[model samples]
Target: MKRRTTERKMTDKERKFLVELLACTPSKFKRWMEGAQNALVLWAASMLGMVLGWLILAWLIHLLVNLEVGMRSPYALGVVSLLAPVCGLYAICSSVQWVRNWPDPSEALRQDISGGKVLDETYNVIEAKRFKEPEHGGLIYFLRMDDDRVLVIYDHESIALEMEGENALSSSFEPRRELHIVRAPSTEYILEQEFSGEKLELSAPVDLTVPPDQWPEQESWCEIPWLELERRLGMPGF
Candidate 1:
């Protein structure tokens, strides 16, 4: 019996998509380093807090019990002081290992889109819109691809509101694509979509600088010109 292989060949468009996805790595990596630094700093602070808390606790116990030699407090403090650094070192090592094992931007993007039930063939980006949120200080790219597919890339601190009543928080790099979706916007814009005759509200109203175009057929679509979108995002036109 021959073994069946499940591997599917990538289309040329998919290859291009991968290239575009790879272009996001520098931004993704910078955010990843910043996160790792923040985590290490937080871990150090927590370890210090633990040591100080133990000292305070030990001192309080000593005061309450009225021990004579004061040996117990010193011993306990010594043990904690020794164990804290070990635990901190272990945490650092674990974090480093995890970082080493983390996936690159392209693979991560594939996972995100696949998890969202988007077919691999439609990974191509036909048109793209980019934006930046002043308050959040993050770059947002809206990719309008084939088959009514939309890929929303949230870089760094940018985020989006879910169709459900929940916050769709983004990590260092997130690629969100959904089927039968006409428009995808960041938290900064108010947009709506109708699927199966049911209307879906996406975001709340904001002071949008990009005015909506009058599309006689598809009024729901936020049709921002490609050149203008790039300009507004502070990126040179492709």
Candidate 2:
């Protein structure tokens, strides 16, 4: 009886531990390395891989073969093996480019949670707007909330609001392609309802309880072009 009680207790504790671990914003790999000194070890490895790949590509192209790619043969086979070097170089370049291109972790995290897999598999949230494309394509803007920080809460998904920054963009492109804009109040933005017509109408307001973390460091941000925003949301131009 005592052994059974102990086993049951252990199982309950294990279950609770897993639940808390899943309730985080950063991924498990990231959270584990958040404060660990060993995190730098992985960083160094990635850097080394990039550098080595670059060097290998340089060697293959400049030193290995002095002629153009030829038909399949023993020599060609050897040279073909060198394709790994070219692929490796591309990977390194891509990594650097990705870092240079992204706005911040905010955008990546928002995309991950917006799919709503964090809370439940069946739940997903989408931003909505209206637009029309006539002579050319139109533009529209989507507001990303700079204030909200989403932690993966109990497998619940998140619908991101606001952007990392704000900008003034073109409303339309041509005479035929025109658009209308409906703005919503920043303070009253809700997670529940989907936007309708020209106004922001949110649903699932009940699902949107208090966000887990406090506001993000920045207050509000946007990622949409005003015209594109309308087009994406299926709004027609009048």
Candidate 3:
């Protein structure tokens, strides 16, 4: 594999554009942490509510029927034990469904970009490179958004400027449409795609900040215009 040196550093405008884009998107780890935290909270609350409901039901049954009812009673123990599996099953199913229905990480970013919420330029671009492989090449951007955050962007050339439902309804579908960006820590070398909220681990993590001579493989490294990047990202014309 021929090793091609990086063409050039990002221009000021290009850096600003990247920074704005990064600002609009959350990192992959952060998103996962948030989802886990939410699920834990939900589970805890549900379990607590179930316990209280069980106690209330037991009390009502004893008051209405004049039966001896206590947590240690055989009847209460039997009922609670039976309900345990049902509650566990319900929690497991609920979590699975919630995860399956979770939206792609880029969904919110796309919405923010379309809604003009990407104007907040909080992140600074540390480094950026645009390159393509020899075969089946499309534009790929490796951007260092900060000291720790790195973004690997796959720009689908085929749908660079295509609009939704432009062609016939049946032929309008495109696999992995528009842009897919993977955000990871600078220390991480493996690339992951959060497609439909599922992490699909791809290639090893690439640290692009190193000299091009030390890069893993040689490819056509070049610069992309800010406007062109915007078009590829499905952003409206400025």
The best candidate by TM-score is 1
Better of 2 and 3 by TM-score: 3
Score each candidate by Cα lDDT: 0.44, 0.31, 0.43
- Name the best candidate (by lDDT): 1
Residue-level lDDT of model 3, residues 55-96, one tens digit each, is 887789789996666575777777767666666666666766
What tens digits encode model 2's per-residue C-alpha lDDT throughout 103-157? 3343434443333222111112123222222212222223322222111111111
Question: Order of candidates by TM-score, top first?
Answer: 1, 3, 2
TM-score of each: 0.35, 0.25, 0.34
Ranked by lDDT from best down, the candidates are 1, 3, 2
Model 2 ranges with Cα > 4 A deviation? 1-23, 27-71, 99-238
lDDT of 1 by residue, 12-108 (tens): 5554554465576556567578657856875788677767776677677768986632335447666766767776776677667666666444555
Instruction: Report the Cα lDDT for residue 3, model 2.
Output: 9
Judging by lDDT, tell me the better candidate of 1 and 3. 1
* Residue 19 miss distance in model 3 (angstroms): 4.0
